[model samples]
Target: MNEILDEMNGHEFKFIYKTELFNEILAMIEKKKISMENAILLLKCIGYYATLKGIWVSDFERSLLKERFEKMIKNEVKKKEKMNENLLIDL
Candidate 1:
């Protein structure tokens, strides 16, 4: 059916796939093999590319994603700061 074909070719699929890739990147960051900043940068870049390619993410959804990524990066920075402080204390 034409409707089914249209649905399959829609932006929803692209958004879902992007979200999954973002989650995978987060997992890699959690495992300490990559930095949170790096992950966020990659996500943003990819999102921008997708936008240019006609993906339709609303401003609200983009804001939410940005907020979550910023929070995660802040947490990582705080963690590293605490670690350095503890190292100083130990020294």
Candidate 2:
């Protein structure tokens, strides 16, 4: 749990692609209006599905990922608030 939180605190998302599927994923993210972290998590899950054949992602992994994603968003929000406060004070 701590490890997950740590990773989320400094997570960077990137993917390589050149297909309609990539555009579809972007469309869904935009439609949902989700955070970048959520979009990256979803993309990771999608990649797992596309690459892995018979192997399956366990329910445990899914649950853990969801929890971590939420934590990441919360942390980001807090950071943004702090930055906004500093900006307001400067202005």
Candidate 3:
């Protein structure tokens, strides 16, 4: 997963990681292993790894990336909420 992430460019990397993390959370949900709230919170932290790349990204860029990551996370959470609502209705 890290290799795949490394191969992606900056903009692409954020989207890809958000997708992969969302999928992981969905799997955990399917397995009845995690609460929806926790899964969503974990998704929000997926971009912390970017901090470790201090040498690669400038402070300004990192801040911008963090904002973008937050927006991506918010969007993912909204998607999950809608899906959960549908699932509940189906049940």
Candidate 4:
């Protein structure tokens, strides 16, 4: 996965929704098997990987990608807040 992400500069990134890889990434984030920072890094790079190289992505894929990643970020923040609350309660 790191290799894929590292090589992202040359990737087409034309169809972010083309495979189940996105779902696997989200699952890794949810399971805390991957770092939140890395997830955010991937999300940030998606557009640059396409836009910088002039790759035309479809509207459907763009919208879906935006919606899903935004949702995952929000959920992560909420979960972190809840966990912090529990820690405070213990204190």
Candidate 5:
């Protein structure tokens, strides 16, 4: 994930981390290769990078990563919202 910290937008990183990283991450989550807690930790780490280098990192490659993140986070939010609603009903 040092790549994530690098505030560059080269095509090399585009392939290495942009196109491939999220797929590997999502696959690991799906396959239970990573725990949900760990996934959140990873996301928070990325979020930290983003906080520091939002404008610097958000070039072509970062936009591609954004598209994927938008979709994934939307779906995860829906699931969490549903779970929260259920818990409130139980309460």
Candidate 6:
């Protein structure tokens, strides 16, 4: 019983730690301290860890993350295109 309790406690601690790490990553992204590419990499690592831990993520949650990543990539592409257009106009 004690061993089981200890194991549960450890799992709880890991869950909390992972949650905090996720929040920190979001804060860094909001502050522009990390690039979108790096953020995606970090998120992938987080997801991998969660998967290895057998933490079940709902399909909706997965879809939301996917949508967010796609949106960020699209926005970055748009920004680059706009910059290129501006350069062409200037030329």
User: What is the C-alpha lDDT profile of model 5 across 1-91, one tens digit per residue?
Assistant: 7664675454443344454575577678778999645765776666565555543333424444346556656665688845544322321
TM-score of 3: 0.32
Better of 1 and 5 by lDDT: 5
Q: TM-score of model 1 relative to the true fold?
A: 0.45
lDDT assessment of candidate 5:
0.55
**lDDT score at residue 88, model 2, on the 0-100 scale:** 29
Scored against the true structure, residue 57 in model 1 reaches a CA lDDT of 45
Rank the models by TM-score, top first: 4, 5, 1, 6, 3, 2
Native-to-model Cα distance after best TM-score fit, residue 78 in candidate 6, in Å: 11
Scored against the true structure, residue 38 in model 2 reaches a CA lDDT of 63
Cα lDDT of candidate 2 equals 0.45
The alpha-carbon deviation from the true structure for residue 38 of candidate 4, after best TM-score superposition, in angstroms, is 1.2
* Model 1 CA lDDT for position 23: 57
Worst ten-residue run, lDDT, model 6? 82-91
Per-model TM-score versus the true fold: 0.45, 0.29, 0.32, 0.47, 0.47, 0.43
> Is candidate 4 or 6 superior in lDDT?
4
lDDT tens readout by residue for model 3, 1-58:
5676455666664545554455555667668899656654554344444544432323
Q: State the RMSD for candidate 3.
A: 11.6
Q: Which stretches of candidate 3 lie over 4 Å from their true place?
A: 1-18, 47-91
Please list all clashing residue pairs in model 2, or write none if there are none. none
Query: Can you write out model 4's per-residue Cα lDDT over 1-91, one digit (the tens) per residue?
Result: 5456445543435444343656666678778898756765665565455566666545434444346656655665688845544322321
Clashes of each: 0, 0, 0, 0, 0, 0
Worst 10-residue lDDT window, candidate 3: 53-62
Root-mean-square deviation of every model: 10.6, 14.6, 11.6, 7.8, 7.2, 10.4
The 0-to-1 C-alpha lDDT of every candidate, in the order given, reads 0.54, 0.45, 0.50, 0.55, 0.55, 0.53
